[model samples]
Target: MSALKLAIVGGASTYTPELIDGFARLRDTLPIGELVLIDPAADRLELIAALARRIFARQGHHATVTTTTDTTTGVHDADAVLLQLRVGGQAARDKDETWPLECGCVGQETTGAGGLAKALRTVPVVLDIAERVRAANPHAWIVDFTNPVGIVTRALQSAGHKAVGLCNVAIGFQRKFATHLGVDPELVRLDHVGLNHLTWERGVTLLDTPDATTGTEVLPRLLTEHGQAIAADLHLPLPVIQRLGVVPSYYLRYFYQHDQVVKELQDKGSRAAEVAAIEKQLLELYADPALDTKPELLGQRGGAFYSEAAVQLIASLLGTDHRTTVQVVNTRNDGILPFLPDDAVIEVPATVDATGVRPLPQRPLEPLYAGLIASVTAYEHLALDAALHGGRDRVFDALLAHPLIGQIDLADHLTDRLLAHNRHHLNWA
Candidate 1:
């Protein structure tokens, strides 16, 4: 077998150490022969590279680690490229996460108006990098570890690039469920469905495990056994879980209790500001020269289990693993959920192997869930149009279509603010 060459775009992120730790620890899963860290931020890259080398050395791994500013050069011979880039950096994120609160909407990186702004700024940049990667190495699989994953992954697939989107949300749930059930995580399978960030864990099945005494429909047992704990994790009332018989991803709180979330966001301030401070401290620690391993503070920066999720995805996709694995990923719906359009991207359990990602069959959702999915899918359609084509009207239309920004007046407010805050990114605007 050929040695695995992995190139990480945006390798300068403070989160890079988390991934590096995984690479060193899970060397058996992915024998990375040559690892390339690609970034334009030269100073950040320097600090990250030094730390990556130290981590590898400490772990006694011999992966040839390298760094570069040129995307084409860094990805030339790589078999897989992971994208975790932010187009305008945290300054843009701070703007995205704060401006929506001005309209009394929940400000977040991957939902509603802020997410639309991020998509408009990010999709184009990601596509450009994918094109460059294709030019250099046609066979390289692009794994997107970026936010607004559903939209970005759809754009890549629609353009015919070989890419899949990764998020740790599903894996985090799996681990939590496994811990609660006292079983190995691999034994637990999630009937995870919906569009990226907007998803629910409707079913939990344990595969031929001795501890799976409750059988495939263990969702109710989970609710009955740990409803309060699960509800607490999602910041939802226990009755909601008992009523719905489904565990909503934490992102659902924005839709389920929009007003509450908006008020909470207003009071707590922007998550971006918190993460910016964390990143600053992390960079200081990275430059410490004495420090090597990933620090605890990195967990507070979000994206828990990100490296494990990415590694499993890459290992499964590259044919390194013998067994086909079911992992949650963002890919085209293709009727996976009957209610959504074929082109709309959704996050769901997918079977991975050398062939490609195939979303497993999803049970029909209740009208309540299906209606929301349909409405959001429509908004995503408009969102992608605006992200790709660019215009004020398109932006307004997308926001107007969103459930969270349904009012025309609010949509208009957000559109102007989005265009104003992101004019440098949206050239046509």
Candidate 2:
């Protein structure tokens, strides 16, 4: 087999180095050569190229590195492409979270106004990259690692690209739940279903065990007892356990918002101001001319986070010896659950390889939980249609279909307000 060529977009999201580190860490286990890095910004690309070369040189491995501002040049002949491009990254995320708070609406990372903002900015860019991949390397598998992942991934898929969105939050919550219950996350079976940032934990238990207690199970008891409070104490943006109960937190903004908590923040000052301050600090660090002098500050910092786990999962599927401990993956439903949609994005255990992803089968959600999941899938499909066709009515129907949005006569109100407020920003307009 030839050495796999990996292409990474958005070379400056701070995720670049970690992914390089992930591939490099597995160099002894799996052969990866010729990393191609692409971004429109030259300075960031230079920094990333320098860092990657230094790391490769240290291991006495000769890795061909390609840096380009052009997508076609970078992605052509690649085996896999990881899309990490952010329309604006943290600066935009803060705006998304702060804008709704300013309007007395629930500002969030993945729902309502903030999500709408991100979708508008993200759709065009993601599609552009997807199209380039199609034109350049028709066989490459594209893994999208962007926020509002359900929306973006759906867009790429509907546009007829082989793509799946990736988020580490689910894996994080699963491990925490396992720790709380004194069980291995791998052994626990999860009947999880929902939209990207908003999913429900319809059911959970040991994968193979003699029938025992129900609510008396350790996982459920732990969640019911200290889940919400722990989330609060941690200041976690999403209430993983509280919103989905036994399910992993799929960006909780879709189901619940602690209005009081947000109100308190507003009462004190502006959340956007806080974001600006953080941005200033990051920008200063990024702009410092002396960063090259400090070895520690030259590349991605902090030990391995879950984002790298996605790559390891892919390596496992490819039959590499570099297997990961745990991974959260999206795979097609092949009757594992009779109730859930066959094409719905599922959170399940998977093994990956050059052949493709293989998801383990699990039980179905309860009827009521399945219905909730259906509603979210409906929104995902419709929103994807709207993004692809530029149809206002489809977008309207998606808002109408959402349980929370539909309950509040949100279709007309949200559509009109967004049409008027974001006419200039929206790609559809």
Candidate 3:
């Protein structure tokens, strides 16, 4: 097989170097002949591309790195396209993290009312980009890393694009569990299930080997021995995990502790502000000619372990290693969960290889978790509807359906605020 040509749609992002480092370190897994960074921000794009070249050189990898503002040119003949673009950038994210708090909702980028705003702004743009990728290379896979992943990915698949959504949550948990178990990270497999941000670790298994298909279930042991540490990592009470017999995603804090999270968010500055400051520092660091590795500061910038996750998924999708691996990915449900529609995009452990992703069979979901998953799944359907077709009522209905803002009056207030802040991006508004 020939070397792969991969394109990153939002390659100018501060997160690019992390990916560059992964590609450099994992060269044997996913060999690339060329990497095209596509972004409208020309200045940042150049800075990131220069650093990417330096990182590759430092690792003695010879893949050519290129930058372009033209989407069609960048993605032309690519084997896979990765979407990481933020629609309105940090300023819009700041709004997404703050405005919802005014109405007593948890202010977050990928949950509740604010998530709906992001979905409204992002879905249309991603679809347009997917079209370009499809036109350029009909067989190229589209890997979505955008916010509100569940809704955005659903839209892509619903439109019949070869798309799959990915998140760092599962990998992050796997790494943490490996540290606790004193085992190789690759040997740990999680029974990770649910929607994008909303997911749980139903079982933690230690594979006999890295590529083994069966493993010993160790979730009960982990909970018994290191439950407190795990709970601390999630910032949830240890009793909660013990009671449910599953570990919830940290994002579930927004739902499990709604009022308290709202209060905390109200008291603190937006995460976007912190990221903006970090980006400024990272850009300055990137400007240094002597720097050849991703800075320590970038780790604090978030998206931890994103590069590894992207590399593994891309390699598996391209069949570079010719091994079918079960990874937690966001893909079509197809009866993985009896409760959701087949078209609904779900985050669960799935078999991934060159052919495509297929959701693996899962143990039945308990009502406690299933109810919230079903509720959010319905909200996601509505969110996609509002994103595809634009209207105030559509936005209102999506927000209303969200478990975080089911109250009519609260949805009313959030709808007006959302449209007000996003009118510039929303053509219909």
Candidate 4:
């Protein structure tokens, strides 16, 4: 087989080295001859490229590390393209996180009115990049790890691009649960279902285990044996998990307790600021040529297990992995959830391969979960529309449809704040 090439669209990000390390660690799974880091910021790209090279060298791999500011040049002839671009950067994210607080809403990058703002700014930019990737290498797979993943992935697919959205949330949980079960993560198969960032692990089956048989449901054991720990992870009370008999994704806190989250955000300040500080520190660390491994501080920056997830998905997509892999990805519903529209992008466990992704059949979801999924699907529809066509009414409708901002007054306030913070990015604004 010929050596493969991969491109990272937002290669200047400090997070790029973590991915580079993954490529080195999982070298057998996804071999590469050249790795291109594409970014507009030449300064950060230079630093990131140096660190990426050092990481591969430390691992004794010869993947060529290259940097480019031109999208077409960077992605040309690549086998896979990874999109992690942050349109308008952290300065913009600061506004997205702070303005929503004034409206008494959780200022978030991917879950509320703030998320809507990010979608508006991000979708068009990402679509253009996808187009460039398509032109450069039509066969190249687009792996998106961008924020507002469902919206971004849906946009790429809607434009007839070959794309799959990857997130670390499900894998992070899989690893966490595996540690609790005293088993390897590969043996854990999570019944992870829902839209990106919004999901639940209803059933966990151990594929290979002595204490339990394959396909055995162990959600109860996870909750009962490690209820407090699980609850702490999601920030939900033990009583909630006990009553539901399932583990909700951490993002659920924003929906299950919207007002409380708003109060907390108001007091705690924005997460972006904290991440900004962390990124600053990481970049400084990345500049140190001696530092070849991913720092422990990267854990605090979130996206745990991102490298592993990306490697697994890319390996499956490239047909290099021999066995069929079941994993969570953000892709079209196609009846995966009977309640959602067929075109709505959903994050659920699917059979991944070079041919394409096929969502597994799931048992009917309880109304408690199904109802919100439906409502959120509706909100996502409006959110995409709002992102594709910039208008105050479209923004208003999306916010109103969101369960977190259903009230007319709140939606109105949120729409204004979103547009105001993101006007420069929105062409129609």
lDDT of each: 0.90, 0.63, 0.94, 0.90
lDDT of 1 at 122: 93
Record all residue pairs in model 4 with backbone atoms less than 3 Å apart, i.e. clashing: none
True lDDT of residue 102, candidate 2: 54
Q: Put down candidate 4 lDDT per residue, 1-429, tens digits, no spaces.
A: 567899999999878877988899999998889999999999999999998888899999998999999999999999999999999998888888889889788889998888988899899999999999899889999999999999999999989999999999999999999999998888898899888988999899987542233567899988889999999878898998899998999999998888898899898988889999999999989888799888989888888889999999998998877657788999989887888888899999898888888888889999998999899889888998988887899999999999888999999988877877787788999
What is candidate 3's lDDT per residue for 223-292, written digit by digit as tens?
9999999999898999988999899999999999999888888898799999999999999999999999
| TM-score of model 4 (CA atoms) | 0.98
Report the lDDT tens digits of candidate 2 across residue range 1-429.
557788889875454656666566667555677889999888778776776766666666677877999998999988778887767666666666665565455666566655665776778888989899999888888887776787787677667787766766565555666666677665554555555665555555664442222222355665676666546634554355555455435345335455664676467654445655644444455454444322444232322344455566555544554443334565554565566566656555554555666665555565655676677777766666666666567667766775556734556666665565456657567
The order of the candidates by TM-score, greatest first, is: 3, 4, 1, 2
- Angstrom error of the Cα, residue 34, model 4: value is 0.7
- Which is the leading candidate under TM-score? 3
How does each model score on TM-score?
Answer: 0.97, 0.77, 0.99, 0.98
Backbone collision tally, model 3? 0
Which residue segments of model 3 deviate by more than 4 Å?
none
- Where is the poorest 10-residue window by lDDT in model 3? 260-269
* Comparing 2 and 3 on TM-score, the stronger one: 3
Scanning candidate 1 in windows of ten residues, the lowest lDDT window is 208-217
